[model samples]
Target: MEQFTEVFLEFINSWGYFAVSFLMALENACIPIPSELILGFGGYLIFIGKMSFSGALFWGMVGGLVGSLFAYYVGKYGGRPFVDQYGKYFLMKKSHVDSAQHWFDTYGISAVFFSRMLPVIRTFISLPAGFAGVNLYKFVFYTILGSLPWTALILYIGMALGENWQVLRTIGHEVSIVFIILMVIVVGILYFRRKQKR
Candidate 1:
């Protein structure tokens, strides 16, 4: 994780706004890149006058939106078939896929909007939105709306902390760990319940 962070930082340092956009795009495309690092460091740059807040924010948001659209299309066009064929390899079953699809159908707008505020879940929600065949316009709209606050918040923290920007990175790391553990526990509980039902 540290290594990946270093690499991303190096990219941002050298490439500036383009790096922010590119890295953010990759992050939102279901890649493991963390936006916290991207925007947080960007905020630091803003504080130091190396980068502008509005420029960084705009590029970051645009990149995220573009990546999300890419992932959404992938899920819409290719996800269902891929999941159907190979989901079991990833501990995903037809029922699980169906449940996810149903959940999106039922609560897609809120889910898409709120998930963006979360740490880990935000990165991958686009795929499910696509798989559920959510309305494109609605999906895009909520994604933009949801991502704005998160982007702005992290950037603000980075800028506010300035020289102590690493603090936000540290906090983000810990938060990610907690969320990951909780997710694992939830998945384990659900897996066990499914086994019992079977």
Candidate 2:
């Protein structure tokens, strides 16, 4: 992990803002690249005068939007079968798709907006949204809206922490784990309840 972090940091350092867009794009594409690390490091750069807050925020959001659209299309065209059959190669799971689908089913279009603020759900919700055939413009609009605060908050933490920005990455990672565990338990309960109803 340390070595990976070094490589990731070096990549961003070498490429400047483009790295922010590329890395964040990969993250939102459900590639698990860790936005916290990207944005946090971006913040640290801002502190050192290597980046501007607005530039980081703009590029980060752009990357997120692009990546999400990519995932959305994958879900729209590929649908569930593609994910079920080939998702494992990308570290995706049927359960993840199901959970995202359930959230969309339960919450409708608003789920797209709100889920973007969450951890695991934020990353996976685009897939189900695409699969559900949600309006493209609306998805893009809400995606940008939902991502703004999260991107800003992480970047702010990174900036405030400066050289210690990696701390946010560590904390964000732990928080994501907790959310994943909680999601699993909720999925398990819901599964059992449905079984009981059947």
Top candidate on lDDT is 2
**What are the clashing pairs of model 1?**
none
Task: Report the Cα lDDT for residue 191, model 1.
Answer: 100
Q: 1-198 in candidate 1: lDDT tens per residue?
A: 456788889889889999999989987876667788899899999999999999999999999999999878878888778757855554444664465455467776667876776666677678789877889999999999889877887888899999898788669856445654665598799999999999
Cα misplacement distance, residue 4 of candidate 2 (Å)? 2.6
What does the lDDT come to for candidate 1?
0.80
For each candidate, what is the lDDT? Answer: 0.80, 0.86
**Model 2 segments more than 4 A misplaced:** 1-3, 173-198
Q: Assess every candidate by TM-score.
A: 0.76, 0.84
Question: Which candidate leads the pack in TM-score?
Answer: 2
RMSD of each: 9.8, 8.2
Q: Write the per-residue lDDT of candidate 2 for residues 1-198, one digit (tens) a residue.
A: 345888889989888799999998988888767788899999999999999999999999999999999999999999988988988898776777788899999998888877876777788889999888899999999899878878888889899998898888669856555644665698799999999999
